[model samples]
Target: MKNEPLAYRMRPKTIDEVISQAHLVGPKAIIRRMVDTKRLSSMIFYGPPGIGKTSIAQAIAGSTQYKFRQLNAVTNTKKDMQLVVEEAKMSGQVILLLDEIHRLDKAKQDFLLPHLESGKIVLIGATTSNPYHAINPAIRSRTQIFELYPLEEDDIITALKRALADSENGLAEYNPEVSDEAIHHFAMASYGDVRSALNALELAVLSAEQNDDKRQVTLEDAKVCIQKNTFQHDKDGDQHYDVMSAFQKSIRGSDVDAALHYLARLIEAGDLPTIARRLLVISYEDIGLASPGAAARTLSAIEASERLGFPEARIPLSQAVIELCLSPKSNSAITAIDQALSDIRNGKAGLVPKHLKDGHYQGAKELGNAIGYKYPHNYENSYVEQQYLPDTLKNKQYYEPKLTSKSEQKFAEIYNNLKSNKK
Candidate 1:
């Protein structure tokens, strides 16, 4: 037991024993009902790391009389899935727990699709990615998706207390006294990750024992332990949000140096590849034609990042960030879309004009749907004046394209033509 991993030995064996995730494990939860009635469905648990997804699955297996088979999708293949299915055929009731199911390729995922629909095996998938986007739609549609939130700070504190008090696997031998300040520090650094919190606690206690002077774990001890241990960077947590905010604001403010710094921070912090791609989208939608090349360069950076992971990828992300920051900024396009959405949401959405609704020019000219609309392509300059907006917003100037060398010329010509037509 001394050589065993702390994560393994501390695994909860019962639902009551499991920590956090009350929304799913509470008395009246759908999962609890299924376990009580022995009628569990194929379900997917979606959440960040160390949030008790595996614990919940194991508890469900223990509660029901089902035969449990576990596999990691990162390493398992179709062959392993086939083997599990074969065993399930002869079992009483089968619960197939697939960890990191999003890591499974489309082909392997498809293997379980038919089996899930036919109710041959109760499939339980655990994933860190958004199931709606990560899992194949066919597979996602077949399973009941349940989102598991990250562990709360209070829950992490509770878990730390339990670990300290429990004699079987806790710090009973060392008799280390843990301070409240130390606990608070651990909880904050854990970032809603239970496993990380527990690991930090175990390490801090172990370090205190080695020192021989004081057997008490202090706030300093916990901080030292955390700094020494591998810092697990969660891309969806606070750091992710903070860095992205900084990056976006830097670009908006046209601070190239600041933007590059934030970009480097995210790269070093292990942000997801897709997040970098999303920033590229903001560059185009917010900056638009002000700097035509900004969006294209950002896209190229995304592709490069995807192809070359990590250290190699950081270069492209830095390049994109700098380029976007230096580009002339404009948000008229974003403002236009946002205003339109707000109007729709506020119930002020007006109808499409009658003339635009039906082709009056092709048939009944007096029907009013398409009576006065002009075709822009049919004109000499391939531009025409038309009332594209609702009557109330007919003259509203939403998109004021920035006056820049790249876009000013084209917009000037178009604006003059449209203004003359309106007169």
Candidate 2:
């Protein structure tokens, strides 16, 4: 018992002790109501690992006084099922805890179905995968599915504090005193996997030498136990947008160091897709015609990132980030589009001129479409005076070229020439 992990020792013995999932185990909750009346049926507890699914199952068995037996689909066989069923028949009913229930073979499922229907066995199937998508429909249909969410930082912190105080089952034997930073680190860095946090806490307490009165667990001690210091990043939250904003602005400002810094931060957060997406936007929005080839080069990098993924994906992402940061910047394309959008939105737009309208359809000539249209290809330098917009919008200008770099200047020269030729 002393050799057992702190997480195993700290398993909530009663539903009330289960801190993370109040909706499932609180007063008048589904599990509570069923357990109080001993009217529990087959259930599937689904969520990510180390989030108290197993603990809740054990808590139910204890409270209901049902014969509890645990098995894994990975190692257990059909014969094992037959034995448990026979014992349940002799001694009333059994509560069977099936781990990785998604992997339950057809033979075992077939044997368990009738037993479940007859109330001889209460099957508690535990799976990390979503039961709806991963579990067989027959199994899902028979079980009440309760989803377990990842434990919040406060809940994990409270659990850790409890473990430190409890002499009977926790780390109290070591007379450990953990720093607040250490405790907080465990709470957040564990990423809602309470078992891993508790295990790390246990190691920190056991390994640290006593400092005068108690084993002082420092932040470094905690980090050593957990292996990595997690930089809190909410990919779907404000921080994600903040970092992205910084990443793009740094590149636009031509601050390569800052851009690379933000890129590194995002990579450590494990959001290559976000970084890739932001980089692609920068290629066009910031680099634009100033470096006309930057967009294509950045796209190639993104494609490589999509294929490689992660640590390797970072290579292409870094290359693109560097290129975009160094390239001359422009927003002419985006500004041009925004101006056109503003015109359309505020009713500045007009219909295509009669001469400019498509006239290839049947009887189009009768309506006078393209009657006076000037064929530009037939004229010198492919130049011809033409009315492309409606009579009300003649000579309206939306794109004014900003030629800063050689590449942009080339486009500006062509635009100027066309404007000069237009009479």
Question: Which is the leading candidate under lDDT?
Answer: 2
Backbone clash total for model 2 is: 0
Candidate that scores best on TM-score:
2
Write the residue-wise lDDT of candidate 2 on 204-310 in tens digits: 99889887879999999988899664444667544577678898999999999999999998999988777778888899998898998999999999999889988
Error of 1 at 384 (Å): 18
Local accuracy by lDDT, each model: 0.77, 0.88
TM-score of each: 0.61, 0.63
State the lDDT of candidate 1 residue by residue for 21-75, as single tens digits.
Answer: 7778888888888887887889999877887888789888887867788999879
Which parts of model 2 have CA positions greater than 4 angstroms off?
A: 229-423
Error of 1 at 389 (Å): 17
State each candidate's clash count: 3, 0
Clashes of 1: 3
Candidate 2 matches the true fold with a TM-score of 0.63
